[model samples]
Target: MQRYFVAPEQFRGGAVTITGEDAHHALRVMRMKPGDKIIVSDGESRTVLASVTELIPQAMKADILEKLPQDSEPAWSVSIAQGLPKGDKMELVIQKGTEIGAAEFLPFESERIVVQYDAKKESKRLERWGKIAKEAAEQSHRHRIPAIGPVRSWKELLATIPDYDLAVFCYEREGDAAQGVGIGAALRKFREGKLLSLEEGRTPSVLIIVGPEGGFTDREAAEADAAGAVVAGLGKRILRTETAGIVGLTCVLYEAGEMGGE
Candidate 1:
């Protein structure tokens, strides 16, 4: 069945209102008609098996048949903070990152970043990134779309460390450390409840930080370590900036038992 995400207000009483692009896709692209069944999510965990009841120009209405079970979201909320890379690599990161269960994406500017920040094009870039996330979420049957945060500076990103229970900084230097904690070890510590959050009771939130093509400077890595971030090495082989976040996020989900059966 096709899945669509809408605002929570769109799901009122026992019916859902689909409008804009999604409606167009259903009405014109999918050639959906009355009585057609589809899955709809409110983008905040409320999903249902709905049957299309009415269709008109740029709009479609569906009556909720039953509430669907919630199992798509990961147990831990994992956000990816990536230093801006060149070309369209950011888009690939957002799309694949959402599919792999990244709760949010934060693109930042670091010392070694190659892409010069362009203020005029930021809005357009963010809009495109958001659309990619939404489409990826729908394709993956995710209950909620991952959020795309406004670009932040290196210092700004570091200051947000307290917001999460744990922050993992992917540093290439760790690969050469004699006693460095690997990504797996860091996640294992999280699983063991060794990492404590300022908030008393809540599902643990994690932030994985990845640098751009040039990677982070030595001083930057030192600052991140001081900001309560656990420095983790990906592996012996260094991954490209775009691939690092996806790999790190997958490691996190797999550690949390989200990849497959327990």
Candidate 2:
């Protein structure tokens, strides 16, 4: 069944009111009408099967059939903190990352990043990225859309490191045998409960940080290491900036047994 994410307020008295782009999609794109079945999510883990009761260009209403189980989300909430790369690679990162169950995306500026940060264009860029995340979430049957954080500077990004239960820095330097622990080992430790957060019963949150094209500078890497991040390597072979986050996330979910059948 086709699924759409709507605001919490849209659900009232057992009926969901779909508005804006989703309404247009239901009315025009999907050609949904009364009696058509669709799934609706409030994006807060509340998902339901609904029967369309009304349709218009600006709005669509559906009567709730039954609440659906929220099983699509991963046990570990992984957020990707990507260093802004050149060209449209960010879009690719956001789209694929969302599909792979990334809970959030954080695009940040780094030392070797080539793309100049533009405050004027940030809003439009965020809007487009958000749209991409939303579409990817709906297609992937995710109950909640992945959040896209506003682009941050190097210092600003480091400041948020404490927010996660565990933060893994995808440093190329760690690829050397003599360097830091491997990504698999770090995640295994997390999976084994060695890295559990102080909060009991809370879903473990992980932050995976991937550097841009030229990768992180030594000074920057040091800063991240000092900021309580677990420095880990993807593998001996190098990966593009956009590829690192997805691979790291996959490793995390796989380690958590989220990629396997229940």
Candidate 3:
């Protein structure tokens, strides 16, 4: 069934009043009519099966038939702190990251990062990323849309989030060669080993940092290490700036039992 997101406040008793883009989407794009059935999520992880009861140009109303738990959310929350990539790569990151069950996304400015978003453009881009995440979440049946954070500098990235239980920083240069534990190895151990309590969640709350196209400078890596991020490698084979985040997230999710499960 097609699903749309609605705010909790819009769920007034029996009917859900949808305005803004969704209203226009229903009126023009989807061309939905009264009595049409669709799913509605409150953007708070709660979703309801709703049927269109009324449709107008500016507004639409749907009667909620039932409420159910959103099953798409991962047991553990994983947040991606990605260094700003050039062009439209961030959009791809947000879309795929949502599908992989990222809890949030952080755009960081690193020493090697070539692209920079000015304050005005940064604000606009953040808003755009949030929207993309929302649409992807709905499409993937995710309970909650991942929140996108404003761009942060390398120094600020370490300073801002200190409470995360586990932090993994992927640098193309070093893997098990330096630490004797590559990303794949760490992930294997993480999945097979009984170190973490399952109730603490499947993926384990982790902050993953992916560097820019030129990769992280040694100094920047040192800073991340100092900030409690375990530097891991995606294997000896080098990957691009955009490919690293996807690989890291996929590994985390796979280890968390979110993908390729029994």
Candidate 4:
């Protein structure tokens, strides 16, 4: 069944009202008619088996047949703090990151980042990124769409580090060779300490910051480390700015038991 994400308020009593782009997708793209079945998610980990009831002009209304138990969301929430990269790479990061179970995305400016959004078109780009996340969520059967934060500066990004239980500053530095333990060790720390760090029966949120094309400068990485982020590397091999987020996130989710039975 085709899946769509909708706001909770869209479910007005008897049915879910699909609007905007999704409405066009169903009415024109999918050519869906009354009695067609689909899965509608509330964007908050709740979903339902719904059947089309009324085609309200450009919109489509569907009556929820059965409330489904959402099992797609991971137990641990991961927030990816990605350094701004050039061109459409951010779009790729947002799209693939959503599918990989990122709870949210934060784009920041690092010393070596090469891209900058113009003042006139920043909102438009943010909107587009958010849309990509939503579509990817639907396609991947995710419980919720990942929230995309506005592009922030280096200092601004560092200030938000305390909000997470674990903040990994993904650096291609000395790695495990000369620096501290690699990202693998950092993930291990969380795995072994997850039970001890639980608050109100919920796993703590994690933040992983990936540098852009040129990677993080030594001074910048030091600042992040001083700000409470664990500076770690993916492995001995260096990854591009766009590739690091997903790689780091997969490792985090995998180690945290979000990718399988724990």
Candidate 5:
């Protein structure tokens, strides 16, 4: 069944009001009629089965039929902090990141960032990235759309590092996985070191930081290490700015056993 996301306000008294581009898609593109069943989610990690009841002017109404059981979200929450990469690579990052279970994306300006976002273009870019995340989440059957954070400076991201349970910065200088410094080894060390004190069912929150095409400077790596990030390598091969986040996230989810169903 096709799915549409609605706001809490749009869901009233067991009926969901689909509006804007989503409604337009259902109305014009899909040619959906009354009695067509579709999945509707509140974007709060919950989905429901609903049937179209009426098509009003510029809006489509659906009656909630049944709330379906869903567990698409990963066991742990992950946020990607990516340094500004040139061109539309950030869009690809946002789109694919959503599908793979990143909870949020933060774009930051690093010393090596070649791309610059002007004050006027910031809002427009943010809006477009948000739309990409929304569509990707819908297609991936994600319960919630990953949030698109504003582009910030390196200092801002570093300042937020202490907030997460685990924060890893992908550094080529860290070398290959055999050296016991890759994300996999780091995560294993973390779990084994803390299993005694850590409680079960307490999902860990993670932050993975990836730099741009040019990568981070030596000084930035030093700063990140000081800021409490585990400076780790992905593998022997260096990945592109767009590729690092997805690979890093996959490694993280896999390490957390989030790649499998409970």
Candidate 6:
């Protein structure tokens, strides 16, 4: 079944109202009409089976048949603090990061970062990135859309570490130090045999920091280490700037009991 996302404001009682760009895409691009069946999510991480009941010029309304609890989300909330890579790679990162269930994305400026965001144009870029995350979330049936945080300097990134339960910084230089137990290994030891209740909240909330294309400088690595962020290595092989977050998030998800059923 086709799936679409609606903001909480659009939901009235059991009916969901769709408007704006999403409406245009559904009505004109997707050619959806009244009486069609579609799935709608509140974009807060819960999905509902919605049947198209009304299609108007500027709006579309769907009747919610059932509220389906979203189980795809990993119990752990991961925040990606990525060093700004050049070109359109950040867009790809945000899109895929959302599908893999990132709670938030933070663009960090590093010593080796080549791409710079201007004060005048950064807001527009951030806005577009936010939209990309929303669309990706809908496509992946994520109940909540991940947020794109404003670009942060290296110093600003370090100050936020205390708020997270686990902070991992991906570093190519910390080669031997990176050999700590894999996320899978950690999860098995820490959380195996735990109850499946969400209210207990035993899953770890993770914060991952990835460097830019040129990667982080040696000093930056030391700084990250000082900030209580574990300098973990992904593996023996090197990963691209855009690829690191996926590896990190995948590990986090698997560790949080979201992948590969026993």
Which residue pairs show backbone clashes in model 5? none
> For candidate 2, lDDT tens digit of each residue in 21-78?
9999888888888999999999996999999999988999999999999998998889
Give per-residue CA lDDT, model 3, range 17-110, as digits (tens): 8888888988899999988988888877568889998888889999988887777777667888999999989999999989878899999888
TM-score of each: 0.95, 0.95, 0.91, 0.95, 0.95, 0.89
Clashing pairs in 2: none
Order of models, best lDDT first = 1, 2, 5, 4, 6, 3
lDDT of 6 by residue, 140-232 (tens): 878788978899989999999877777888876545555654445544543453224334645566788999989888788789779887777
How many collisions per candidate?
Answer: 0, 0, 0, 0, 0, 5
Tens digits of lDDT, candidate 4, 156-197: 999999889899999887464556578888878776875475
For residue 216, what is the lDDT in candidate 5? 91
- The sequence of per-residue lDDT tens digits that candidate 1 reaches over residues 1-262 is 8999999999989999999999998988899999999999988869999999999877899999999998889988999999999999999999999998999999999999999889799999999999999999999999999999999999999999978888999998887644477999888877767545435556678999999999989999899999999998998778999999999999988887887623
1-262 in candidate 5: lDDT tens per residue? 7887788788888888899889889988899999999999999856889999998558999998989877888887899999999999999999999999999999999988887668699989999998899999889998899888888889999999999888999998786645638888878876677533667777678899999999999899999999999999988888999999999999888877877622
Model 3 pairs in collision: none
**Which residue segments of model 1 deviate by more than 4 Å?**
177-179, 195-201, 260-262
How far in Å is the alpha carbon of 247 misplaced in model 1?
A: 0.5
Off by over 4 Å in 3: 176-180, 188-203
Error of 6 at 144 (Å): 1.1
Point out the worst 10-residue segment of candidate 3 by lDDT.
Answer: 194-203
Top lDDT: which candidate number? 1
Q: lDDT score of model 4?
A: 0.87
